[model samples]
Target chain A: MIATDPTPADRSLLATLDRVLRGNFTRREALATGRIDLPVGRLIGLCLLLGAIYGICLGSYSAFNGTGHAWLQTLASALKVPLLFVLTLLVSFPSLYVFAALQRLPLDFRNTLKLMLLAVLVDLTVIASLGPVFAFFAASSTSYAFLLLLNVAIFALGGVLGLAVLRRATRDVFTPVPPGKALEPAAPVEPGATPPVLPPALSLPAPSSRTAHQAADQARRLLAAWCVVYGVVGAQMGWLLRPFLGNPGAPFEWFRAREDNFLVAVLRTIGNLFGR
Target chain B: MNFATDENLLRGGADVTPSARACLGVGAAGCALAGLGLGAAAGDVRTALFAAIKVPLLIAFVAGLCLPSFFVVNTVLGLRDDFRAACRGLLAAQATLGIALGAQAPMLVFLGASVLDPYLLTLCDAVQFGAATWAAQRVLARHYAPLLARDARHRHALRGWLVLFAFTGVQVAWVLRPFRGTEGFPVQFLRPEAFEQNAYVVLLDHCLRLLR
Candidate 1:
């Protein structure tokens, strides 16, 4: 005789994930169906003002230090060059635009903020690890390590404060119209009057098992794709820089060659490694 | 009779759909592989310890970025899957990347220093600014853009970009300034090397040139 089985916790967890994904997709659909009522110019102006303030703060810090001719100052000056800044901006803009588009979908601010922080944390990890390597290569001794630490610390501090301020300000500025305002208050029913009946089809559907399987599959695919892309890119970079690997200053001078030979050589080396 | 039939059905269902178990098994295997790779690459206990310290940081980063997405996706998909598991997997991936990048830091630093030769610090400064700005932009665009769009607060987006630009700007200025031989206070703060390292002194000397 067969025995009865208990519902597993994993089943419930999968069901919950499915619900979230569905909610976001539904919200996106709703927004697409709704009217666009935002004032673009005002928004742009606000952004510009904020940018100006930040710029002023940076400039003030530089001027007050009296060491504007120092290493930090030189770094800051190099960043001022339009071409370099623009190039960096261009590469990242598309990704930002996609993020903005995602934001248009209804999601909780708390959840969004959490994700942003996580991303920043990931970036910090990369930077921190990269820092020591840089110090080592630059032949920097113990004294210079403090500078690296300070730079990293300042950036991290700035990020935390910025996120806090942005969250508070956004909440105050973007109030949603209450549901009562959105729909005319249901005509006042007489005392004990029968409540308006909802259609049977409008009732929540029973959660399906099929949806859970599908979502898991999608997530797996996305993760795999991400891994592949990053892996390929990393490998390519490593290969291109291989010949210069053992050379004392090859990594530094690799970018200066006008001919494609250097890149070709690196690529061939990578190809051979992979081929093996 | 009804109870007996229901029990049979449940048993059959469980036996037939083992994908969750399979997925978990695969995930575990992938993690093991990653762990092994890290161990081999590190070679010794001390190196492993240093790398291990970065693991929590790596987890924090991945969780910080992907958790929301995981929640949102799960919510939208109506799946009740384990959010923690997803987070763990992503964090592991991030840690691997962090380790890989860390391994190469020495080379990058050396390259950066080489670029500092012949007073070519200006070019080195430019590269750092360019790379950092590029990275910052990518983060803002990929990670922060959605929140800005959702809230209709474009200011956050602008602020994000400006912060990155500001960072790059500062680095560039510090690299290119004409300092003959004295260590300017800012130079002291901004030196990218260890205090005892001659590179710091050399960099400080550059800052002093302007003072003279």
Candidate 2:
């Protein structure tokens, strides 16, 4: 922990969140500038707090709440969504870090971890924001599959937004960019034209403009890798931690085989819905 | 257990009492008993009793798979004293999980009495467990934050260690299946069924099955 807390003028959580949500890198850039060093502890704390809040809001919904234990489960539901999100990130971060390093984009694990958490924070916020709507549908809907699909859609949408936030934040921390400027791809170089050389006095992205593109590509690849790992781990984790949504058709038991994973079974059933 | 923890533990020194250990044991056990166990809410007393008996074994089963790799990770990362700390932290997380799950026992009982359909009961069971386990993970992360703090040189390795946790945890969990009672299965201490293939293959099959 820092001896002195960041002064209010330096930055606020809300301001940074707004920046992150909008895919603006100013706040993170500020972090890079050393104007404010948000403690990793604080960042993680905020992430967990957001996770808890998000879980509580979204946990209240049920495709069917007629069961005797539904209310109790709903009470604990607040913890469920955040659990899945944070757990997925934890499960996936290591591989992504490996891939980023392989790309030679030498990422600080702490900063990368911070960005990963922030992305999930964005995700949970979106999910929480949609909680009320989903809750309404869950309350009214009788079709478990339809409600499940609706939630899957919302989660995916939120994930896309969150990954975008992470992507923007990653660029800011992994590669230093000049203050007060956007990371626009450098003007297409004219073949055989002498490159415009600015004096070394000003801080700028030192690497060739091509490296910027490479970093962007690198970040994209890293995200995809993380996403795939997260997807598989998350789905299996969900399966292992089974009975999340409660199977209306079967008696309440714990985990089943890996073969019964929600992802595959749902996808298969959905595919069959069309094929048949 | 105490010696293993104190003499050469993973992350930090172990800090647990016999009573504390018993408490975690009883808590997880009680959950599996009384028709209020984790994974699946027991539909009947017979099932609950069967699960209750295996709660301790279940913990060991998971740890057996995870700890060896975890130790290797700590050594490779050169987190010497942190090894005990890590082990302590993991056990503490498990205890925290047991406590959280125990906290919801009343509600689970309420649901058992009230809900008629198995699906709602099962989902609630899974969701509550998720809440409890996530809470445990938060504690574990806090413990590692410091150990992994000085891990700047090997951020990739540190991440790999964390990945090790997830990989082992999920696979171990997969093998220790029937956390919820599977459909049409009798209440048994362990499922007694063996995997037709390894978990990876099975998982891959699941993926491939989706394409079909």
Q: For all the predictions, what are the DockQ values?
A: 0.16, 0.01
Best by TM-score: 2
Worst 10 residues of 1 chain A by lDDT: A198-207
Clashes of 2: 34
Q: What's the alpha carbon RMSD for model 1?
A: 22.0
lDDT of 1 by residue, A1-276 (tens): 001122354235333223222332123222222221222332233323322332232222223333323344323322322222123223443443344334331223333332232222222222322232222222223322333233334334433433333233223212222222222213555687564331121111232432534434433443344334333443343233222112221222322334444346545544543332
Query: Docking category for candidate 1?
Result: incorrect
Q: Which stretches of candidate 2 lie over 4 Å from their true place?
A: A1-5, A8-28, A31-36, A62-64, A172-175, A178-211, A249-258, A269-276, B1-212
lDDT by residue for model 1 (B32-141), tens: 33223232232344333333333333333323432432343232223324334333333323333333333334443454334435346436434543553353244334
TM-score against native, each model = 0.22, 0.45
Count clashes in each candidate, considering only residues at least 3 apart in sequence or on different chains.
Answer: 87, 34
Model 2: residue A271 alpha-carbon error in angstroms: 5.7
How would you encode candidate 2's per-residue C-alpha lDDT over B5-105 as one tens digit per residue?
A: 22222233234322345535644543454233443454655555555555445555555544543443343234544666666566666655665666666
What residue runs in model 1 are displaced by over 4 Å at the alpha carbon?
A: A1-45, A59-61, A68-89, A94-276, B1-212
Error of 1 at A185 (Å): 11
